[model samples]
Target chain A: MKNAVAAPLTGVPTPDLASIFGGFFWVGISGFGSALPFAQRMVVERKRWLSDAEFVDAMALSQFLPGPNVVNLAVTLGGRFQGPLGSLAGVVGLVAAPLVIVLVAAGIVARFADSPHVIGALRGMAAVAGGLLLSASVRIARPLWRKREPWPIAIAIAAFGAAAVFRFSLLECLLVLGPLGLLIARIRRHPTSS
Target chain B: MNSPLIELAVVFSQLGLVAIGGVMSALPDIQRQVVEVHSWMTASEFAGAFALTQAAPGPNVMVVALVGWHVAGLAGALVALTSLIAPPAVLAYIVASLWRRFSGTDWVKDIQSSLNAVSVGLIAAGAALITLSAAQSPALDVVIIATTAAFLGSRIQPLWLLGAGALLGAAGLI
Candidate 1:
């Protein structure tokens, strides 16, 4: 989670609005396919805006809240230094290019949606995407197993069953399990406090 | 009320609030809302949009924008993207300001660890369901999935794998 390169920068000036905007904009442009890995590079290593610890904190904060992890990281870091406008600049800069690109791609796909070749390509890519998702799932789960706790693992299984097997709506799953999970956490933490 | 734009706004905003574990964990529900509940797109069309968004740069959340585009237009895309991101972004900003105060609290740590586990489970379900809808050739897709998983720890860029998938598809080999 921590990077050695994230040692606090001693002489780096506080980034201005333009730099924040431009920095994230560059992240948007170069972040082909995925942005997090590059966002980490830019924020922690290249800019030294956030230390490795701070970047990891930002990531945790991003995941703790909703939305994409990278966008959340940008907004949080921007807000940390520059307040609301910084948040705006960070999000807008990060999203600008990708929004246009996705829109254009969507248009092209619409036009060729029926083409066999287009279908084939999309199908192939979709399968690959599925694989990527699987990898991400396993990666995320590995930590839970390493923690050696039964409750977290049990919660994971229940969640997987509810969504993948029972076909519960996301809202339903969250409503039933979100609080339960939180309560379990609280109980585990305060085993003697309560 | 019946406007696709309005529907897009409502659905995405709701999703934005509950999109724990990032957007990946929300994929199955998103597919459900857009495809099953509203019938905005077929399962394959949803899968197609997911693929396109993955191929494009930026966040995977843009799949919402693409779905909106399919249903309404440019305006729809903007509405979907904004609604989906705006609420969460606002929440993120508020929490970031407060994070320093709560950073080392045991409760915060518990919540974080708990959410991590739940997120993993949801993401796994999403991956399985999406593959079921998107995979055209089951045998080939399984191989693709396994190979991709194996190489995940390697240094190869993901774009290469995506590009390879497209080539295989274009050649009708997958």
Candidate 2:
């Protein structure tokens, strides 16, 4: 998947490490609720290091593996462009900004956990977080729903039903779905060829 | 104290490596480990801490720091946060390098596309679980469902909805 184009000459102007780090830092810091969509917009659309196809690929891979999707995406995309060092840079940029903000907020919450006002504020924030998460689900689902694949859609429904209704452990649910997905893919690949 | 702190760091570091579909998907495992196995906190306490983390403005993984802080102290919080982020960051670096080399293959593309749909399902399931846990009262349940509907409707920006929820809470309606 290495792009055929040569790396930009060292002396030529390019997006500096500082600028790239800053961009990811802001994106990470501002990610209060809907960080994934915001990060996608910044990296894929605004920065243009990756095309739509590549962005989708990176996102897909990240989601399938462990860790936060945004962090994984950063590493994947960064490595694609600038090797292991770039991946390190991207991860630092992506996480440090958000981690700092969260630490400060946690301290504030600990200080005021007993206060009525803080309690009320937290309640409200919780509701809003629910909204944010719901919105993200819809945003992610919209594209997938458009694909018109019955099996994937069926698997999605079954997975959701199992988790939401049966309260299956996340690992158990994935264990059931992961192999099923792989089997389906294999079948599709070698259907008549097999 | 040192043992718990180290344990907290190690467990959450392992969690960071396996937290697919964000922190929420890992919630079940976190609850199982911390509340059930380690006896660090009660299930209710973990739920409460999760509420706080959701309210806070950052990734859900930040909840690890809050839980660690509660379990030990500032030092615990630092350990938990580092463990939660650092291991996964390193893992992502290794995986990214390999991905870049092999991503051009047809099978890779096909598998990636199929997994996208599955990811959406996992995320939705996680949200549904959170909604159930957060809605304690019938009125609050209605509000939660309404907010979810509003989110799905695409009627307003999520931040505005947050502002409204906060205002309602301030007014004692929520």
Q: Candidate 1: misplaced stretches above 4 Å?
A: A1-10, A32-34, A192-194
Under CAPRI classification, how is model 2 graded? medium
Model 2: native contacts recovered, as a fraction? 0.49
**What would the per-residue lDDT of candidate 2 be over residues A1-194, giving only the tens digit for each residue?**
34412233244334456656765776777676546777778766676665577667777677766777777776665665566666667777876755566667767866877876666655665666666666667887887668766777777777777666776666677778756876786677789976
* Each prediction's TM-score versus the true structure: 0.92, 0.81
Candidate 1 per-residue lDDT, tens place, A151-185, comes to 88988888899988888887788778777888998
Query: Model 2 misses residue A91 by how many Å?
Result: 2.5
lDDT of 2 by residue, B1-174 (tens): 358888997788887776766676666567667776788876545655665555445566777877788788778887887787777767766676567667658776556555555556767776665555556667666777788787778757665666676667666677
In model 2, which regions exceed 4 Å deviation? A1-16, A44-48, A51-54, A77-85, A142-145, A161-168, B31-60
The number of clashing residue pairs in model 2 is 0
